[model samples]
Target: MAHLALYRAWRPQTFQDMVGQQHIVQTLQNAIRENRLSHAYLFSGPRGTGKTTAAKVLAKAVNCERGPSQEPCNECPSCVRITAGTVMDVVEIDAASNRGVEEIRDIRDKVKYAPTEVRRKVYIIDEVHMLTTEAFNALLKTLEEPPAHVMFILATTESHKLPATIISRCQRFEFRRVPLEEQTARLREIAEQEGMNAEDPALAYIARLSDGGMRDAVSLLDQIASFAGGNVTLEQAIDATGGLPSEQFARLATAVRDGDVSAVLQEIDDMMKAGKSADKCLEQLMHYFRDMLLAQLAPDASSSSGRVADPSDLRQLAAGFPREKLFGIIDTLNRYQTEMKYAAHPQTMFEIALIKLCTASGETPSVQEGSAAGASAGGAQAGVSSGEVSKLQARLADMERKLEAALKGGGVAGGSTSGASASGGGRSSGVSQAPSKAPRVRVKLDPFVAAHDSPQSKELTAKWPQVLQRVKEERVTVHAWLVDGEPAAYADGTVLVAFRNTIHRETTERPANKAMIEGVLTSVLGKPAEMVTTMQKDWQEALASGAGASREEAAAGEELRLVPEDGTEPAREPIIEEALRLFGEELVVIKDD
Candidate 1:
């Protein structure tokens, strides 16, 4: 006989031999004993949870020569033939390969005939979700009302993809993943049966790596046993799986807690040089920290089976991490792990995440705000006193008051001290004068409004939702501010967005925010686009003031032209001329009040 893989060799032949799914086994056994079997059955769960195994066992139970018994007697010729797949009435179909309307139609045709070789003609369709829409429809009628001598069993890892109509016709049973302890015991049982020498921790580690899949755990144990020449150890298991030891993760965590970037990076570099994958390393590290967190939060609770570290060591490590810092670290690791899934250079992302953890404070704030006081107060560090923070806040409030007064008094066009002092009439000498706030630079909307009904403008309006979606994907904060704005007009490779809220308009006009929005627009619109923001009220006022005059007026020699009192154009300020020259006449307009 050829060598049999451990998974297949140890396949559960009876419900009594199966592990970690007692609920399903007991139910099926009672149903068979009482003769209350459904015509169609749907077994759904993660891989290696005994879906297919249960199906085969049920088939044998229903057709065993002794009787239609709850347990199939392997000695009986009927059970033997079914187990060997020599029985003509028992059919196992790989739906993934034969997922077609024709194949399902063939099954529909064949299901009507009586069983030729057994009491019940059993059909087991694995990965039944792979069947196409037409195939599912074809199988529906037959599955709902099969012949009295037939039973249909469908198995799939993903049950959500099955159509509602098909799902409604079957009796569904969800198989749960095997628990860690049960899986470990199964591995130990297999090791002892095969006369392999394996340490307890090595078997447990293999079980943990399998993530609750019995077949995967057994296969890994077999592979590691072969690699270790039949004597498996923890180190051998780790080496075979490319897994890092708990000690390495502890050292890395210590470096991060101590804010030692060099040590963290060096450790990562060494691991990478040893052929460890960045993503796998990150995943292990995340689990290690999770174990530590659990240890800290619930000191009385027993340790997780997957954690190989000693309880004392885990408690000691957990002591160094505060609850809040642990949360932030976990959150950062999770975010970076998600990004690394699509990253071309995952190692760089991994390194950056570690470096971030090294430098982050215990109470890492998600959003950072920079104030004038923080900028002016040089040498400010985390050790700054509460009194100092209060003083800075007071200073910021005073500056804001002065700015409000300056705006109300029409101080100046730019932040000019001389202009502010000259404009501060009847103000108290004790009150410091703030520099005038600069006038907002707005896009000249005459051309845009005239072409507001053009194809480009309409296209932008149609694709505005896509732009908002892309913005949300890039930075949700930007989207919160940009969502209030609408594409008011488009002209000359520029998009004019009008905002209803002043704060939203100002925030959307920030250089960084504007650049990100423009990038999203360019990608979605398939053209180079620039975004200019203005208040919605201002845009409406401009449209009302003849800015949106029909193009036919200009074509009929009725152009609206601006002229000075002396029959020549008025001279513009040097700054205004420069602005017009740089932004174009259609995007820059002088506003004097």
Candidate 2:
């Protein structure tokens, strides 16, 4: 006897043997028993959901020598021939390969002929959605009104791709993905029948990997059984599926909750080194957090299953994270997962995503509990009442408000006498005291401030690194000149670059240097923006005046450090901006596949 694949050997032989699609089976059985067979039938669902199996059974039942029966008696010659694919009356076509108009026209011509040996002729076309428009047109009339001696069964995973006219003419039965319990039960039955030594957990794990596909589950089992010599363990199942053990997932959760970026990256690196897919690693982690969420909401109802070995570990992990934080973590992973499809380096994306999650702010209840306990004990020991705490908080808030008012009023937080006097209101507008050797520079501070506050300016600020890189690539001299300055204000496609000295400012304002920077801005931002140069002192003077600060104080305070002069680097893209773009003003984060 030739060796047969497990999925083929254990293919469902009858409707009674079909699992997790009782509704479709019952309806089909009733139709068969009542002799109410439709000329054309359409079966649609995900792969490995028994569409083809049902089609074969229907062919056998109608052609069974015993009679048109609810169940095919494989003992009869007609059923045996159909089962063995030797029956001329039954034709199976792979629509993916034979999807041209000529093939469908041939079927139309053949439907007029009588069955050679069976009671009726049957044609099964799989993946019918692959059929071309001309082929579908050719199939339409015959599908609508097939000959009395013929039956057509069309199966497709994507039913929405089928034409409305063809779908309307056929009786449609939607097959469903097998439920988890049912899939587990079926695998257990198959394991017993094959005499394979497997624990229930091992089979269940295989079922999970199958992802609701019975054929896939069986295939995975066959491969693992071959390797393990019929004695399958839970570890073997996990290894075969390329899934990390529950302990690793728990460790990963702990690392993330503790904000241990290095540990998280190490665990992910270890998994990738072990040959597990980066995508699956992220998927499993997402599910782990999802389980934590379930544990928090329904502690008693939560099942550890494939997520964790110890249910208490799940509960402990869940307790360490707030509901909102877990939601954010899941959402972040989901966005990266979507991007992974188009990304050239998916592993890099995965690592970056987890690193972000580690830094996200959300204190566990335990951390909050400690703080609260300390506050209460200290307050009680000092004989302070809640009323006093409220008063102190109000007083502190008032001080903060006044400080912000002072800062906005252009009072330097701390500065020398001369800077304070320069910033004081006595300084004339558009003119600052300068040494006899240096002359004051004139600039339109109002236009520069307005432009800097524009939304486009903020966008440019966020993507400034990319813009700088583009500039470096276009012309190094322009980048060199621009490096000394930082964008102070952007408005109406004009950027004000503030420099520490007049020399650099004058150098950047040259026609050639200015044009190069603007060209790069246009390439990066999709629009040309004028680059305006301003001396750092002049820019600060404008800022103080606009902030209602006395010219003396604005000039008196230490120089503003908003733009680093000595080649300071930009920080990682702001988390708040990224979060806003992802979730859009919602407190909750929803993960999408």
- Give candidate 2 misplaced runs (Cα > 4 Å): 1-4, 300-313, 362-593
The lDDT of each candidate is: 0.77, 0.73
How would you encode candidate 1's per-residue C-alpha lDDT over 95-159 as one tens digit per residue? Answer: 99999999999889998899988899999999999999999989988987888998999999999
Worst 10 residues of 1 by lDDT: 422-431
| Per-model root-mean-square deviation over C-alphas | 11.5, 14.3
RMSD over all Cα atoms, model 1: 11.5
User: How many pairs collide in each candidate, listed in order?
Assistant: 1, 21
| Candidate 1, pairs of clashing residues | 444-587
TM-score (C-alpha, index-matched) for candidate 2: 0.64
Candidate 2 lDDT (Cα, whole model)?
Answer: 0.73
Task: Give per-model TM-scores.
Answer: 0.68, 0.64
For model 2, how does the per-residue alpha-carbon lDDT over 1-593 read when each residue is reduced to its tens digit?
01239889899988899999999999988998888989999999988889999999999999999978999998999999999999988999999999999999999988899998999999999999999999999999998788899999999999999999999999999998888688888888988999999988788777777767777888888988887889999998788667878889888888888889989899988988998888878888887787787778777762324343334458887898889888998899887777666555678888988888886642333344345433443344344567644433333333334335556877422222331222221111111122232223244456555444567768888777887787776555667777888878665445677898667777776655666686777688886555556788878877767744443443333333222234442232222223234324322121100
Residue 445 lDDT in model 1? 57
